[model samples]
Target chain A: MCESIPKTMKAIVFHGPHDVSTEIRETPKIEKADDVILKVKYSGLCGTDLHSYRGHIKGPVDQIIGHEFLGEIVAKGSDISDSEFKIGDDVLSTFTIQCGICWYCKHGYSGQCDKTNTFGKVGLPGGQAEYVRIPYAKSTLIKKPASQDHADDSVYVLMADIFITGYYGVKKIVDFLGQKPAVGVQQLEIKDATILQYMVLAPLGVGPVGLCALRVLNHLGFKKVVCVDNVPSRLEEAKRLGAYKTINFETEPTLLKEVIEKDTGNVGFDAVLEVVGASAALKTAYDSVRRNGFISSLGMGHEPLPFNGLDCYLKNINISFGRCHVWSLFPEALEIFETLKGDFASFIDHKVSLDESKEAFELFDQHKVSKVVFDLTL
Target chain B: MCESIPKTMKAIVFHGPHDVSTEIRETPKIEKADDVILKVKYSGLCGTDLHSYRGHIKGPVDQIIGHEFLGEIVAKGSDISDSEFKIGDDVLSTFTIQCGICWYCKHGYSGQCDKTNTFGKVGLPGGQAEYVRIPYAKSTLIKKPASQDHADDSVYVLMADIFITGYYGVKKIVDFLGQKPAVGVQQLEIKDATILQYMVLAPLGVGPVGLCALRVLNHLGFKKVVCVDNVPSRLEEAKRLGAYKTINFETEPTLLKEVIEKDTGNVGFDAVLEVVGASAALKTAYDSVRRNGFISSLGMGHEPLPFNGLDCYLKNINISFGRCHVWSLFPEALEIFETLKGDFASFIDHKVSLDESKEAFELFDQHKVSKVVFDLTL
Candidate 1:
């Protein structure tokens, strides 16, 4: 796979707020016994990566900036074994890794593990680079479908972040209060459990997280996936993906409440997923859910939205805030994706060569793509 | 029992903001068949009564303000039958009366019944006078203990309002979602059930409501009752009543965090009682409890406290608000009070004659008394 031992590899790094540039950096090395080296074949730029680019949410400046990726394992540490994986195996590694023995991992909260390590920004070098080292390799990497060619990375790569995140985020609704996955069933034993038969996804920003939420809800037989967003393109995309209804925030300033009450008998929506990391979206998500309903906010906002304690007490709603643990859910999410193989590939809106990485980020910064893939072989 | 029928009995009227005076008016005639006349033997003043007196909370200017009381049933209307109650019987009536047929009553929330009526500030002539009319007599009046004399009105009257209010407040933790009380176990044969183990009672202002909460909790065997109040005097009362912990907002500004982390193990309290009608206290009760916890607020607040919808949604909390359904729980509460007997009198901090009623209001208004009892016969 190596053409030569180069001094550096092409990567997209944030120069400062609102600026991203392509630069050369030495290929990352596996530093620990549990580490594996992988050559990134496809990487998707996310809204959070854009936030990092804009310096909205704090992170390391000048750090490698993409997280969603599919790649091939090229090397392994001495302590690594091939029980389920081998060098040269095509796979998707989540942005995060958990040792499976942590307080968070043992409790099924691998996303919040005290010892969690992420790929992009604030951790070992990210997948934006040509070669990246993955720690706790077994916990992070999920083998791609055996029938697929290496060139088909776009179809399965999302199992790395977006797809699994949506699945994991909903799973968290049941997992947050329980000791294990089994215990989550116990949590639902709460009496007068208000039944949430309808769900609304707020501010459907043009990204995989929101779409994956819609896709998964559809797959689970939720007949109505109300989409709320001002942008016509995103709303259209949502409708195309089988959303039962779409509300343009421009036409309906109170779209969230209007849609929720209309569908859920003038009370509230059963569950609301805040995919857009905006204060207004967060507030809408909070206000539109029914009593004892669930809200999962996957996007981290720039500032802490002001909270009203009295209404919260009076309404008795539940709000969960955290990053997604794609690693913990890849197996199931990948199974779903592989079952519908080529259908998932349509999520890729653009493909760019490593040499065009800078322009790809610029387009992403300008809201030009939903999913952008970096083609290493180009 | 009939004294000369004065055109008016001695009445306390709220002329304007904080302007209260005792004046005599015609004793109100019972025009409805469901109504009964009670000779107010021992009427208690509550913080909500003070609210009406001070005009902090709005009520009719000429309204006679007393809701909590124990008295003698001197007269009954044609529709009254002594199935569970009778005339010449010493009894206590709740501030509210449920028709026992409305959706609310059928659902066990007798407080919010469609035909329910309230005495005192809520569009009814209160018991501050020598007699007051109680509608829906069968559901509103509870016969006093057979072994007790009329002199026990000081404590027995509290059971009609404050004590039962506190008792039913804990009913919010009854696992109602798991199984209805009237329903059999065979109906809920599902093996999986989430049981609640802890409850948090946040009494915003420590007056009668908070104290009654302590007395009721002490009777129900709930070992962890955390009383939250802004006043040191109220906290002292909470401590004396055997509260597991008292969160003093004046002392600890981060009272919510402390209460949740310490008492709730950082998840949240099982049931939160917003006894204090203050907006801030309502807010604390909401923020301190965990997901799936119960929030029950009694009476109205001066201003609407905006709620935190997201936080509540993530936690699966449920909010219920209304006046106490004193009759629904009076039988059990009377049993508890009977068991306490003379000991329940500790709640009576001040006992005054009918002539000293003005002074009683002043002490209750100044927060000097936990409960003020008016002895008319003296």
Candidate 2:
């Protein structure tokens, strides 16, 4: 446990697109009233990290790059007095932090908060360093289960972003409260009948969001997680994370019909999650869902969504696309990780030290790793 | 009353696409015990009737032509002794005569019944004749309210088609009973807290279905019904039917967004009904609806729906499409027309004699009339 601040820390900073290097910089300090300084233990590379590495994100250099992370609190702000979080508390941080008292936060939509903050961006130095600063610490940090070992925490690291995003997708359709009966074409009279039963999961551009959807479905008790991807490794990883089935569109272009028939006996899914931002993937997700089904998109593909409004209207389908409030659902995701211990970390197949940032980034860029975890013990 | 079987009757028979000639034909005899003979008092020309006239539908050149009609029952089968109707009761006939015990009929979806016997089609003689045979009379006929004058009954002709169609669209989204709160986006809970308020009504292609939605909303007590259309006449009809505002898409390509903002204060609609089967109109309905809103489409536009599955899954939208079951909701519509006679018939604007079928067909084809009532009384 550290009482005084350290002077220097080793970190990987993104200078520009495709230009990532190791540097010795001043250790991050606890600045905001609700901020906490965490001694970075583990940071995972995600697809967005790839996007940033490729210079797709509109931003400046010198942003400590990385969003998915598990760490230990090194220091707490003056206002933070959580009994559960001490200087040595092993915890994970949500990628986006919310104050949790705003209008969106009150509505459980902290992901869309007005004053929300994201990690590893220009404004926020993320967990790519030994010392990482976390804003809205009370709402963003979750303590690891005391019973599980550190290696077990890697699978649950997705609680920071991906898993919660998937759960939020499913929650929108079916009322989780488990009341009222399901509605069909025949029982149109049973008003207020929620038809959120079918789901579509488009892991279009594979990475964390796709895998996170698989992990979250398993954690949330969904037996069948339909995973769509062109890459075989990611599909294999999805399978291991308990995806009911994986359809490689590279082989089966008619995957939508297969998935539809498999679950709904030829109707269509009730919900679909498009993790890829490509226009084609978006269209496929919309077509695959049946009458009254819901679709959730987490990828930030910058192209204007080629929205077919009239078709969507006729199908009675609903669609919403944008960024997520990672801060709001972080707690529930943490609870899922804590409760479901063994399976969460299975997605992380490669582990490396902070000094090997170049090697880790290369493996990630080449799609050679499921999840490249940085062991900050160095 | 003595009943005598007739060998022939005056009938309007079709010779070709543009030609209809009056011919003397054998009067339709009751074949089934469930059939009733109606002495045709009035018949109406529908857009589909014109479609049939233009050689759009596959039928014999010499087949009978009209479907929409009002009549007085002159003969009943031996098995029909229901007190609901007698030998001289005036009634309106639904286009399709459905057997009540069939799978679709028993479930109250007689419109989709596999064995539906449609009038004026290849297998049946039509109501354009002086006397028409109706099968399953108890299920398909609605006795005209004794309070209204016979001339004013033309207004109720729509009950056979558009009125019931619109009511079905509204009933699909809102709870009409008032005992159950309308189940829609407003009632959806975000995560574990928060309730969304407000809804959207995106009506694509303001045809009969769209106008029907506007009328039903008035009956259902919705203050704001956002109407979308390209034709000025349809938009005008929409306004007359109580739409809060109408957006003509032909004038503004992004009319969907404008209608959504105008009606919902920019949040989007809670529920939308897509009446136009065009792919673009479907997309418009999709774009205008807010997160978790309901979109129900009743249009039969033929085209592969350009669907975005991921967006729908995440947003938790509900979509239902295809033909509406008129028989299931006809009773409700009949009640509206019976109780609100003067108010309901304001939408009917055209009346013509049987010999003027060509003129009526022309007006309907040219969009010169909303409804053309064929006075068979000639």
Candidate 3:
């Protein structure tokens, strides 16, 4: 396993706030019984990665930083069973390491496992590199579905986090709507087509996360989903991806009235997807949802949510807030990616070599680019 | 149809805050063709009634004031199907009027229906009377289940609101746990008995609502439930109702430490049932829940919930807030009542005559009594 490996490989290293560079580093090896060394194929930029770039999450300087990675395993540990996984198997990983035996891991709470560790921070060098060591690889890395074998690996990088996250929130909304996907095909068909009376709000104008959610919503036979943002171009992008309506909340002084009075006949929406992670946007979601409605919010905001218990109770609002747990829903997201690979790739407008880590982060920070992926093959 | 009924009857009339009196009033008649007259049997005094008494919810003063009622249909509208419900059938009424034709009612959101009006407020006389007019009788009232007909009518009164509320919140917990009941019996059994490592917190020491929830939790075969309160008597009551652990937060200097370190071994509870509608209690629920845990909060509070968006995001918390819609879960509550009628009635320490309206309200307001019901037969 070590004979053919290089002594040094290029990795995007985080030096400080607004400081990231592709630097030569010694290749990682399989150090543990369950560890596997993955040859990184493609890795995408994410909001959490930006948190490091902007200094909001502060110094873990000189470490490789990216959690969304899809790749092929080049080496495996002795304890790793070959039947479940083998060397050269193509795979995708969750944002964090998971010890499969923990209470959280066994119960489908992959994000909060007892032995969980994020790949990019706290001393774990992430996949913005040529080769990465994955501990607990048997549990952490899922095989690339045969259905998506031919799909672009960049598209599957979305599966590592954003696509699954988008899918997670949409699945929750389906639960809220009481919509059950058909047993075999597993496409959520709203029981009554007339249930189009129920509307959903997804912020598809910001990032790939919301657009991916929009894509799943349309695939589920929903016809009353709305997307909102200030940018006309993003709103147009959302509309192109099957958003039923769009609101430029920046320009519309009557955003609430329009959504409530025009779109939903004054009852407001049945569910809202909050991906903006801002109090103002959360307020809009709260204000637009009808009594007994639910909000599936995955936005990672640092601000306090603007909500009072009495206000929520009075309207009978239901809200589920969290980051997506990426284990169970991985295959489902891959299944989705098989059909909408190009549509998902449309959001990833920037694909560059690891050397452009500085430019990519800068462009993403300025909102000049919506999504970026490092082509490690480059 | 109501020829045998008396012209005048005893009623509890709210003249002002802290001023309720038993007075003889003209018996209610079927004023609308959609109305049905119910001969009140048992009427529960609720926390909302205290809201009126304490002038918190300034009311339609001088009106009959009770929403939780069990009764016999004395007379009914011509449109009310005699085949479905003949005169003299025992029935239970939801706390509010529900018009079945509305989208809310059709979709099981009976609490927020198009024609939702609380029975005790806004000029509609509630069930604190010998005879009460029930509008939307076809949809508002449900027949007493044959199983619970022989049980205490007061326990069935619990079904009208609190029992169902407790059940609603618990059902959400079941959803959160991803525990599905058996297809036939519909009792949520944890897939693995060892999964009891997941804990739940229900404030069973506060009121009949929490105890009623505790009853449902145990019936579902859940083994680990903790109850918290300052009162020793309430904690004892909770223990009697099958709480596995009780924490008196007031006396415990290390309340969070005890629950986190000792009870759950440092990971917090898997779910929290929030029925105490105060900021402090909500904070406790927020603190005690583990990452990826859910808080099924039905607590209606006036103050802002003490939480920041970032903290909730970091914890990956899931919270659902609402008043329970009583229509769909009524039969399920009756099923629980069939088994736990005595246990539910154990919490209702006050059973008084209609003439004792003032006494019952005073006792409940002062916390001298846990639950009170007007026994019309007295």
Candidate 4:
């Protein structure tokens, strides 16, 4: 493993806004007892990186800026045993390094762990490089199953964040719908579930996460979902991803009302899955849910609370909000990802090499490309 | 039943701010086919009625104002049947008259029913009046069980609002704790529950509702609960009602932090029952709760939402907010009320006749009395 490792690696580095460039940098090494160095094979450019790029979310410059990455584990620290994670094994990095022993993690809220650190920020260089060091490897890395080894980058890259996130939102929705995971089954699937018996569901924002939510619902054979988004192409993608119906929020504003009246008999959706981290989307969700309805939100917006306390109470709303506990939901999401591989294949619209980071970021930032991945193996 | 009724009755009527006068008003008769006249035997002066008295909540004056009342059903409409409900049976009034046929009612969100009306406003004269007319009587009135008939007005008056609201908050908290109702049990009890495994809990506001929460938690053998309030007398009442510990919010500002660190080991309470509707109380709840904590709020506040969306999202809070669906929770709440009769009997601090309305209302509004009720039988 050491002989194959390099002294320097070519990688994309972040400077100021829209200023990502390929530079030869010292390859990341195991810096901690729990650290593991992965030879990056593929890494996806995430929406959050755009926040850092646009300076919307302040962060240190000249750092690596990618979160969704998976590769061959080339090296590890002394504390990492072969049985836990070994050299030459394929693994995916978790978006955040969360201490699994914290109260939040123990209680199924790993995203809010007491000791948590996100990759691609501060000294934690991201996966957008030839070699990246991942601390807390036991909790941060997911080994590829022998059955899923052939899935490759386009499919498994999502195993890191968005896939788990979208599925986590769906899990919360399913929980809110009062349907528990069937006895003896660890995955989140409605047992003996029939579409006729299900409640009306509306998933706002047809981004990658929203698309995944629709797919998971579809896989579970749910047929009452209506997806909303302002982007037309994404709306089309939403429909393809098994959205029972799609509505463009920019045009046909009456579509939601029509759906609410016709589908729910004027009562709003039984639950609203909000993944768009914008106040407008939240307001729409608030207006579109029935009283005592559930809103499962995974949005990361910093806007002031959209709904007034009086309205929230009057509506009798039940809301489950937060970043998804990706580690906790990974297995279930991976199962769904494996099942929906064919449908999610189109998700990675661009696969550029490390040198094309500038063009890829520009296209993704402008929404010219639906999704982009850096193909380090190229 | 009609032969036993009278044309005129003595009642306490709300005329203006701080003015409730005893008046000889015409007795209410059944108007709707489903309506029933509950001969007011005893009625509790609720916090909401105080809102109506001060004109804080706009409503017509000269209307009787009391929602928590139970009495023998003296008369009924033509559609009445024995199996459903009948005259001569003792029944308790629900806080709101919700139509059981609506979608909201069918889906466990009865509080937001499309066709719903509250007593003590407009044509729906409240339970403070003798021979008060109740619409949608089947869903608005709860018949007292023969087993519970020995438990009279004071214990049962709470059955109408605070008792159910507080219990509802606990029910939400229990549900948020991921404990499901045991099979074959319709009530919300943690079957085979153990105090050693229960999460640290904090119930803010030692009012009647908060006190009920403490009592119910105690009934279920939950030990790690702390009750908070600014009122010293209510705090004492809370302890007697089964609060494991009490904190005077105005005095022991450090008490919460101490409990958080000492009791919860600084992780914060797993679940916070926020019964006080004020913004300050909500802020306190938000601050006191743990990351990924569950906040079950039944407070009816019109204050602007006190939480920012970003903060709420980051904390991963699960909030169940709204008026308790009193009619829906009647049987369960009644069961607990019977079980805790001795503890809840002291809830009513003042009981007087129709002529003492002025004193009762003034005392209750000024916090001179913890609770008050008009005993028409007196």
Candidate 5:
């Protein structure tokens, strides 16, 4: 395995805002006893990566800049047990490293773990390279099916972040509707018969996470999924993924709330999944939801969202916002990926070589691509 | 019963902002078939009453002005058939009239009933008189134990509004903590062991609702309950009830967040009950809650509470605001009152005849009294 690994590998390195370039960096080694070296096969660009590239998120200069990746274990430290991980084993890396023994990780809230550190962003080196080092390998690495080849791995790359995030938003909405995950129930049961059956759903921001949420909702049997976005391509994609209705905010003179209420028979949607971090989108979710409806916020907006206390009080809307507990949901998400079988790959609109990452970042920022995956082998 | 009923009764009526007056008005009779005329023995004034008196909440001119009352059913319509209630039976009225058959009512959310109307506010006539009609008596009235007398009924009178409102606030916090009331569990159990034990609590605005919340928290065995208020008397009352610490915001140089953190071992309060409708108090609650903590809002603020979405999102704080489902929790609250006998009466600081209601409103408005109860037969 060491003979196959190179001394240096090509990586897209960040040097402050809008200053990213392909550079040769020494391949990462096992600095900790629990660390494992992975030969990167695929890496996906996310909204947070764009933020880091734009310097909205501060991090070390010249850091390898990517968090979502699928790879094979090339080398492991002495402490890595063969039962947990082995060389040549296919695996996906989580965006954040979580100590599985922490209180948050133990309670299925690994996103908020005390020692959590996101790769390529702040605390750790990233995966936008030919080889990357993974710390806390036992907890951070999820084994992908050995039968799956590179041609079908893009969806698995998403399992690292956005897919689980989108699923988390839907889970929050279901939980908000009082349908907790039962021990023996095969499907989520609606606890309240009067709860409007959650027939209609609107996913604001038809970005990668939003599209994933739409697809998941479609798989979950939501009857009328309304997709909202200003981008025409995203709307088209949403429709192809079974969105019952699509609303383009830029072209429509009527407010989103008005259009949604009209489309939903003037009662408003049963629930809205807000993936756009903008307060305007949140406000649309708030206004478009029916009484006792929920707005599951999975966005990361910097601005304060103006909430009318009286309005929220009277409507009794439930808004839940947080980062995705990706590690906790990895097993179920993998099962879902296997079940969906190539359905999620349609979201990968562009797969560019590692050298094209700088341009990919610009294109993604310009909304030219729905999802951009980095082909490390290219 | 008809011969003993009077043609007129003296009641406090809302004419406009600060224009409430005691006037002799025609006594209300059972208009609806399910309506019952209650001869009000005791009526508790609430913060909402002050809002109506200040012209903040619109209502009919010269309408009776109290919603929290304990009374005897003096007259019943022909259709009254609920075996639990009858003429001459002692009862307490909920602030809002619930039909008990609407979808919301059937689903245990009577507070959101489509036909719901708060007494003395908006369309419904109120109970601040010798006689007032209560619609949907079977769903709206709770039978007072025959063993309890009128003098010991102040706590029961609170069941109509503030007590339940306070308990509802606490209930939201407990629910946010993931401790739903189990079938036979006497105490609310912390479902998640990793969830910080809810040791410290702060009830902002030590008014009737705040006092009731503090009392409920005491009964639930919470340690280190902090009461925040500018009123010295209310603080003393809170301490009398079992507040571990009291902060006089008006006199404190430090901000509420700072004070709370200092009092709570540099970690913010586990949960905060926001009872003041002011945005400032809501802001304090937002700032004082620890990570993954809850802020249960039970206040009615006309102005939009300025919420920092990013801050709340990053902290993973849960903010739930709504009116109390009083009818649904009446049984448990009554049992709690029975268990904590005579303990809640300290909240009734002053009692006066119906004629002195105008002065009582003024004194209460000036924050001179903790709770003012109107004695109809005084």
Candidate 6:
């Protein structure tokens, strides 16, 4: 099945901190009974990839460094079931491969599964190469929707990480606000009222994830969406993408909380999406939310959060934070992407060939681009 | 109506820290047009009352030092319609007087209303007296159900604070664990599965609130409830009240997380009800919850909570902490109290006349009694 594929292919490899290069490497093959080979089509550079590149997230030397990709299956192992997924299928694989039978996976928390492993991190090969091997192919590979344009395919690539993550963050916020008692007859009505009253939301840190969250929240019919960021370009993009208001943190001498309070008539936002993963950003979210509000944190900060438990207690805040279990939201995300119909394409400010991935990373790290997609076809 | 009632009454007044005395004070009258006067019957002592007594919670020097009470309406203002409540009606007033027309009151968060005021707190006169004034009578006073007796009335006294607070804590934990997606067909099934799989609950601190929480959890069909505290008598009381396991922290050298993990087969409790306001108890609750578990904090700590935000994020834990909006759960709590019969009366380890209230306060502050009730009939 792999006869037509080359043994050696071009791949972007992570060598060490501040080091990445396009190198010729042996193409991955079906290594296990459940493994399948994928001919990579498109890959997206994420914040975590930047973290890995900067050595903040340590990994093996000479490791392939990308996780978000859509690809066509080229080969399959002997034990693979062609009935469920066959050769030549266009698919998008989640970064986290869940066993599907683990306790966490069964409970809809696939990201925390005991057998879960991520691509481009410590244990598995990444999707930035010409060809990659995917384990647990049946459960991990989601067949791409039959929308064959590059723009549509770019949306699918986002479904592998940031878009789903952003969606999950917003979903959590809505859930927190709309949570109702288990035994109330008026639960449905209460939930509806909660959502209606809590239409105002703020997405902090207008990076790819935050922008996507803004898009998702707007798409969900939230009328009052505020975008906060220090970067002018990102804020502009956020404004273009339906932020009711934008706050440039760099220009504003006032605190973010004060700005939000002023905009929200001192009621504060019903929810804050903290996507920067810094304590300051989280604190802003905490301060900007009204009593009985939510802070949905999507950022991965390594530092111990500066938390005032008393403040959280007094405010009655509900905070939901963790990695996005992409597979859990995969079906809905694909449907949303289809409905969006190229709206998400505006987020991709830069596109580069795999050869220019190093430059792309540097530009992304410096906040020169909102999102950078690697056109593997190039 | 005014001629029959006395112009003055004996009330427990707070002069300063550790300076509480029974004094003859001017009797409360119908200050608001919607107010009603009640002849105080039974009043319950609470941890917050102790805070006010110790000056940890600031109040007027002559502020009354009680909030939880049940009584019979003696007089009513002209605006109070006798349709829902009338003179001589047995009733219990929530600690919070919710206007019911405010945004928070109408939205089911009456405790957070702009016009909400707590009895025995800064702005509201308390019920630890011969007679008490209740504002927003129609919304604030809950008519006692037909099944009336002194024992049942004592349980109703709990509804004004600890029992309702305890019930609210458990409700929050259940809501956090059983949280469903805002948009999904399988929400009901998912919620059921979540509750079934996550039946193990731990209530930290076997105080009156914690004991009430245990009783509520047990009544809710949770089979594996663990009670943790340092007091042997309280632990024994917890065991008597339906705790599946008990962990006395004073005698146990092992960490709470280790003990819980061992008890739960290396999987921690699905939810923790933290009734002690101390940071150590909060930390223990945080450490003992499983991944994606919930910690419902009911305690009010003066100091900032010792928090590790990274740990919370990585664990994917859901923490809901706040003062109990007791009025929010008033209806359900009343129903539950009725079904509980006199079962909750065991928590009242001491009952004294109004004259012996000083000794009762000392005993409660020293943890020599689980709960103290003022029998106004004496």
Question: TM-score winner among the candidates?
Answer: 4
Q: Which pairs, if any, clash in model 3?
A: none
Which of 3 and 5 is ahead in DockQ? 3
Candidates in order have lDDT scores of 0.65, 0.67, 0.80, 0.79, 0.77, 0.77
Evaluated at residue B274, the lDDT of candidate 4 is 87
lDDT of 2 by residue, A187-252 (tens): 345432223232445455546666656665655556656788888887787777777778888888
Decide which is better by DockQ, 1 or 2.
2
Best candidate, DockQ: 3
Top lDDT prediction, candidate number? 3
- Itemize residue pairs with steric clashes in candidate 6: none
Interface RMSD of each: 12.1, 7.9, 8.3, 9.2, 8.6, 4.7
Error at B296, model 2, angstroms: 4.4
lDDT of 6 by residue, A227-281 (tens): 8888888888889888887888789747555755666557677788888788888
Which CAPRI quality tier does the interface of model 1 achieve? incorrect
The better candidate by TM-score, 2 or 5, is: 5
TM-score of chain B of each: 0.83, 0.86, 0.92, 0.92, 0.90, 0.92
Residue-by-residue lDDT tens digits, candidate 3, B1-378: 768999999998998888999999999888888899999999989887887799887877888889999899999888888875789999989888877766566656677778788888977899988999999887778888765256566777787788888888888787657632111111223365354555888862457788888878888867788888888888888899889888888797577567677877687888899997788888888888887788888887888889988888878787878788777566656667777787776767899999888888899999998889898877
State the lDDT of candidate 5 residue by residue for A1-378, as single tens digits.
478888889998989888888899998888888999999999988777777677777856878878999899999988888888889899988888987765456656678777899888656889888899999888899788766555567667788898888888876665565632111101213364433346455588888788888878778767578888888988888888888878888997475656555665565776888887788888888888876667888888777775778877887666777788788777766667676747777778889898887799889888778788898766
Give, for candidate 6 chain B, the lowest lDDT window spanning 10 residues.
Answer: B181-190
Error of 6 at A182 (Å): 11
Prediction-by-prediction clash tally: 25, 39, 0, 1, 0, 0
Error of 4 at B322 (Å): 0.6
Per-residue CA lDDT of model 4 for A1-378, tens digit only, reads 478898999888889877888899999888888889999888999988888788787765988878899899999999889989889998887888876666665555678878888888887888889999988888788887665345555567777888888888887777666632111101223333355445545578888888888888777767778998889998898777767778987798899999888877888887889987789888898899888878988898788877777887889888988898887667667767877877787889899999898899999999999889999877
The CAPRI-style docking tier of model 6 reads acceptable
Instruction: Give the TM-scores of the predictions, in the order they appear.
Output: 0.68, 0.70, 0.88, 0.94, 0.86, 0.92
Deviation in angstroms for B128 in model 1?
A: 4.6
Q: Evaluated against the true chain A, what TM-score does chain A of model 4 have?
A: 0.93
At residue B237, candidate 2 shows an lDDT of 76
